[model samples]
Target chain A: MDVIQIVVIGLIATVLIVVVKTQRPELALLLSVAAGIILFLLVLGKIGSIIDIVRDLADRAGIGSIYLGTILKIIGIAYIAEFGAQICRDAGEGAVATKIEFASKILIMVLAVPIVVAVLDALLKLVP
Target chain B: MEAIRSLVQNLIVIIILAMLLEMFLPAGEMRKYVKMVMGLLIIVAVVQAVGELVRWDYRDEIPPLTEKNNEAELSGIMAAASRITGNQEQKALEQYKSGLSKQVRALVHLHKETPVLEVDVKVQSGRNEPDYGQLKEIILFVAGETSSGKESEGAVKEGVEPVTVQIGSTIETDEHIENRDSPAGAAEADLISMVANFYNLSTEQVKIIYR
Candidate 1:
């Protein structure tokens, strides 16, 4: 049911962008970004439910909430960064999109640093 | 055997969760980094599961990440709160001192015979002191008889020196009143007692410096 609504929105946005692109490229870009945000918003509730299920599964398995939280955060950051980069690419700023991706990679690495260290530490402990 | 079975079950659940999360990862450039992190999560889960089986206490080596973050953030919040409280307390004390000085100056103005030039009030500000915020002393600068013309500002500034009456305790003030040889001294003593009584303070605490 929601899929139909999303598809309709995407179709309408595509037609509008095709119609407006020749007149004002900047407005077309804005229209595309707005459409992306609208689509994301429509599915935001579903994302929350999915996250809750993951958290519940993590709890049931006796996995620490911290690990689950970090994984979720990484997923969120990746999603946002990918969205931003795509927007930049759509605006014909490939260099800016690349930079955004680079920043996201670094941020993702920083968030993973502790886990990496923990893994290394555990490995070292097991060796001894 | 039961513990081994449960450990395997936890590992299976963690793997399944990891697979589910991988499905949500953004395609293209970001996918590899997300997948790598996901792989690390699985590794961590496996290591923890093995550690649990052996009773090695893997969690002890690495602290609760969220709790550590929260503790650091909590300390920062507490520091900011204390800093704000100290600044607010200092501001309140300054306002209280200035307000008291204005009240004392106005109270002295009620006396037509002795014109007050200035009033300095000190209050007990020590937070630990039993009499904190209580008035400590009131120093009144009363104009002398020679400059009592009320417009003798220049004369008072240059030549005529105001009399200094240091009032202390109710008994000392009464003694000073008895020993007062000049009419002006007697009037100054009366003015001091009136103020002391008005503020419900001891006459000794109200000191008048005639200028």
Candidate 2:
């Protein structure tokens, strides 16, 4: 698969979605969602090595992986929330999408508390 | 990094294909639910990918089930089973062959004249059936078991190494007693009598067919 191939794919999908939307709006949404999911899965396999690289970098920095783990979780929450929000918006559920975004932000905030506390504690120690 | 790049490329291709396929699917009333499910699936996948990116295999922390599968354990069990069954099968085969050898000892005189070869017994058994009580059926095939062509001593030394044979089981009958004057007929008569006497059954009760 190359740029041209992806462009071809995008062209095909765009045409199909356009044709489907006019005949069946629901099917168009389903098509778009399915495409999004498939794209996500394809990118998933790529992420494993990226994770390895990040872990390697953290190890080099003499940082505990616990904080890095938390950060990863927060990142996941944010990404998922945005994804859900987008899907909801596409499905014409603005309120539901907004709620999803709100929930994701809260979850991410909660997840970051430990890191934030540690950072603050370190700053206070430096001041003292 | 190159692998990841290729993966992303493939993913784009897959997305396009999925779009084409989903476009053709029936737009059911649960469109919102369908979208939610798809989005959730992607999100979970992404989370898993991201978790794996940091090599955070949290699954190792989870407790195993009582009967979780272990490859080494399973292989050992399988090997032990195969060894046991192999021994049992060999034993059963020898027992059957010896039984046939004894029953046809009188027919040794007949083997010299007739096309009668030694009986080969193969027992088909299920996995758990060690004693072979669940043995479905026994196949009896006879091939070049005659030791007449080779040196008699050499034949004894060669031994029976379980070669493939496809012939069916054959039984001698007394119905042709009227033709007992001929050598083949006489051999048949003797065979029927010997087998019937051994099994304590009338010759009429036994059924034998050749393939």
Q: Which ten-residue region of model 1 chain A has the weakest summed lDDT?
A: A119-128
Q: How high is the lDDT of residue B206 in model 1? A: 81
Model 2, span A36-110: residue lDDT tens:
676677668767877776666444433457765765565566567667777788778999998886776666566
Candidate 1 CAPRI level: acceptable
> Which candidate ranks first by lDDT, i.e. highest?
1
Question: In model 2, where do residues sit more than 4 Å from their true spots?
Answer: A2-6, B1-211
CA shift of A44, model 1, Å: 0.7
Which lDDT values do the candidates have, in the order given? 0.80, 0.51
Error of 2 at B209 (Å): 99
All candidates: DockQ: 0.45, 0.02
Alpha carbon lDDT at A74, candidate 1: 89
Task: Give fnat for candidate 2.
Answer: 0.00
lDDT value for candidate 2?
0.51
